[model samples]
Target: MDQDQTYEYRGYRLVAKPADNGARCWAWRDGVPVHKLIGCDVPDAIQRTRNAIDSDLGVAARDGDAGDAAYTRALEAVLPELSTGQLKMLQARYRAPDRIITATELAKAAGYSNYSGANLQYGNLGKAVHAHHPVDLPVRSNGTLVYTCALADSPDLEPSATEDDSHWRWRMLPSLAFALCALGLVAK
Candidate 1:
């Protein structure tokens, strides 16, 4: 098949031609063949090719290494069972480095009309973090939360003065008591 026979769509040149075994589609970017789509209809192949190109371009534009590092940290923080939306939220949070993110902001970015949906997603994220990490995250009255990267030093885990310190202390008391009991400093 002649390489000249190609179709351009969304900055990608697609060519459906004969391969050694069967017909396949080749997607080229900047005169370099980047992807091969096999065993799919022409439209499907074209869509897949466009998606691949878009994803590649997005990563390239966003500093792929930094995005990858943030994504990796997010993966470590969250549970294995995560939805794509939840994963995106976590990635955005991790990428921002010391920013306190709210469910409303995450929901807005995720294209949701209401914070309720985002709240549920954030709840899931919190559960995943608590289950996996040794530290408990501080939660605000408005349901906002903060997460610093694992590389951060001397993170302030203290509850706000306005917030009920008793609530926070109570939540951690069981664990603290257990440690004291283990050290024989306190009776069980």
Candidate 2:
């Protein structure tokens, strides 16, 4: 390829090279090299390089289609009571790869100051989840903590599940909930 040509995948720029029988690749931005990899074949090398660039472009945590769908569904359920601006701020929490909103934080968003008290008067977001089907719980970034509103009257929600779909769900008394749920109170 010509030096004038550039490969843009996700948000980073990659430089392509041809090896004896395959392709080699690297990425740079502002003179900083972020990744270097050798692919088994030319196409494989290009794909690998593109994937590396994409994964590193602040989307290290790529959500599966199911995760994205869950986000949209939950947002639809949570947005009606929120002013457009309020919704925007909450959306920002999910904008980056690793932001977590606690129950306390979400409580404030719902206009409740007490961490335990919920603002679930009729037509409120909380009320909707409790009244009907549960929304898919959002996955947390590796170190984030947030409460899920899935269980009734419980202040606990599960953290992000691993690739195998295993995680912890806390209850009102985290210890007790942990004890019982640890024994298998949560849905798999």
Candidate 3:
């Protein structure tokens, strides 16, 4: 039987509808559709939505904030699980001005022939991070089970600045950046 489970987090209302394949989840803020996802399960759906709220759409740690400890720990836990391509993509974002990067640019930086590869790798990396810490949000698709979320800031939608700008551009969180530095994952 399909049941609609409703929840509230970070001032957003979440509804998860379970199906044969998985759960379809949605989040609304101030009655506006802010995000959606097809999660592997009901809890996964809700957790993913909560993750988005806790990290991406909310105020994360700023420079030198002690509140960043959780993000730092999560990144450190997931570091060993990242592939070279994934690490490269993260390094590129780390080196980018203000830590903001587009998927296409990240693909090129990580030596992937296409953005699709970068999306997959990055999304998978997001899963790894999520495994270590559920609070780290990874963007999920409303339509498919594809991993499009990267282990970075949720993403700032920049509409129509360019063909690429139409996509959600990511900014690396300060905690993740500092974690990379602390672990010597990126060159100083």
lDDT of 3 by residue, 1-188 (tens): 48798888778899888867657789988889788975445654565566666666665432222324565677788877778898899889877865778888889988999888888888788767656655523334664332333256534545324555325577665556656666678754
Models 1 onward score TM values of 0.32, 0.28, 0.55
Q: Please give the RMSD to the true structure for each candidate, in Å.
A: 18.0, 16.8, 15.3
Output the TM-score of candidate 3: 0.55
Model 2 root-mean-square deviation: 16.8
User: Taking the tens digit of each residue's C-alpha lDDT, what string does model 2 give over 122-179?
Assistant: 1244334333434334445874212333321222234434322122222221121222
Encode model 1's per-residue lDDT on 1-188: one tens digit a residue.
Answer: 33324688667788875444324678878989899864223333343455466677764211111222343344454545767676555444333323234445566656667656765665665455444443434555887543322212122355323343221211111122122223333221
Instruction: Kindly report which residue pairs in candidate 2 clash with one another.
Output: none
Candidate 1, lDDT over the whole model: 0.44
Clash count, one per candidate: 0, 0, 0
By descending lDDT, how would the candidates be arranged? 3, 1, 2
The top-ranked prediction according to lDDT is: 3
Model 1 TM-score is 0.32
Ranking 2 against 3 by lDDT, winner: 3
